[model samples]
Target: MIATNGDLERGAVDDQVVVRGAVGDDLAGILSVGHRTWLATYEPIAGPEYVAMGLAKWWTSDVVTDAIRKGRTLVAVLGDEVVGVATFGPQDDAVVLWKLYVLPGHHGLGIGSRLMDEVVVQARESGHDRITLSYLEGNEQAARFYARHGFTETHRETPGSGLPESVWMARELGEREQS
Candidate 1:
């Protein structure tokens, strides 16, 4: 039920982006944004084969549907279009950010930052001391973005997918007012 709106004056002038919790009806939009962003962001870094493998393994509608059912999904809407998504939930006693993607065309308009802000808000509200996430090793953009938001690399691993090494990162959370 969490929802908020912000104005993005760049790119699409006067664009108002809304961030809100995902519901059952938002499955299609979530899947669409996730698929498009994944292809656009990872294809260049990992090549077609690796992107396909990872998509098949993780981006299926069923997987997203299940996450929504568990109340662990959020969507950023620009007008009537779903432009960004983030999914997070508890894992091993820490909140794990499973996914965060903003449409390539919507990049740099603060949509991703808005989604991330919501993630931190939720983590703190849920009494989590830390948040964790992993990105492909070569995704320098992701690394820099997370680092700017206080996440620091904790370790690295090569998942069975064999695409590339994964860099795990984490950030400690403190009580703060939601923005």
Candidate 2:
């Protein structure tokens, strides 16, 4: 439902990227973004084994399809390419952002922020009081990005696999908007 496109100044030509709900057709692009970003972002920080474990476990057709079918996944597309992705849904008392990643080449281009803004809007519209997410401890980029979006660290959990601890963060939704 968060279908919106913005023209960003890139070199001399404008690039239009749209952020919208993911569909079954988006499975491949979603997987690609997840795989590329996972490799580029985590392979160094968490080691190749850790990155391999994640790719094997998370970046699968079945998982991405389920998220899309649930109507909780969003994808940022430039023309026909999936440049970024985010998926979230109810987790206990709050809406937990299960995943959010942008292609490394697309970083700092506001695509992630646009996806996040839509997530916050959707969460608020759904009557949620807060949005929670977790990032690997050493992913400073993620930590700073989420913090910039007003999320504060709540706790950390050790998943135990020679992997870094997952740092949980949350941002209060304040009040729900009247429909």
TM-score of each: 0.87, 0.88
Question: In candidate 2, which residue ranges exceed 4 Å CA deviation?
Answer: 1-15, 175-179
For this target, which candidate reaches the highest TM-score against the unseen true structure?
2
Please give the distance, in angstroms, between residue 62's alpha carbon in candidate 1 and its true position after superposition: 1.1
Per-residue lDDT, model 1, residue 147, is 82
* lDDT of candidate 1 over 1-179, digit per residue (tens): 21223534454522467899998888888888877878888888788887787688878888988998888999988767788899999987689999999877767777888889998888878888899999998888888888888888999987675577889998888634222
Report backbone clashes per prediction: 0, 0
Per-residue lDDT value at 60 in model 2: 88
Candidate 2 structure quality by residue, lDDT tens digits, 83-173: 8999999887789999999988777777888889889888878888899999998899999899888889999999886789999998888
Global lDDT of each candidate: 0.82, 0.85
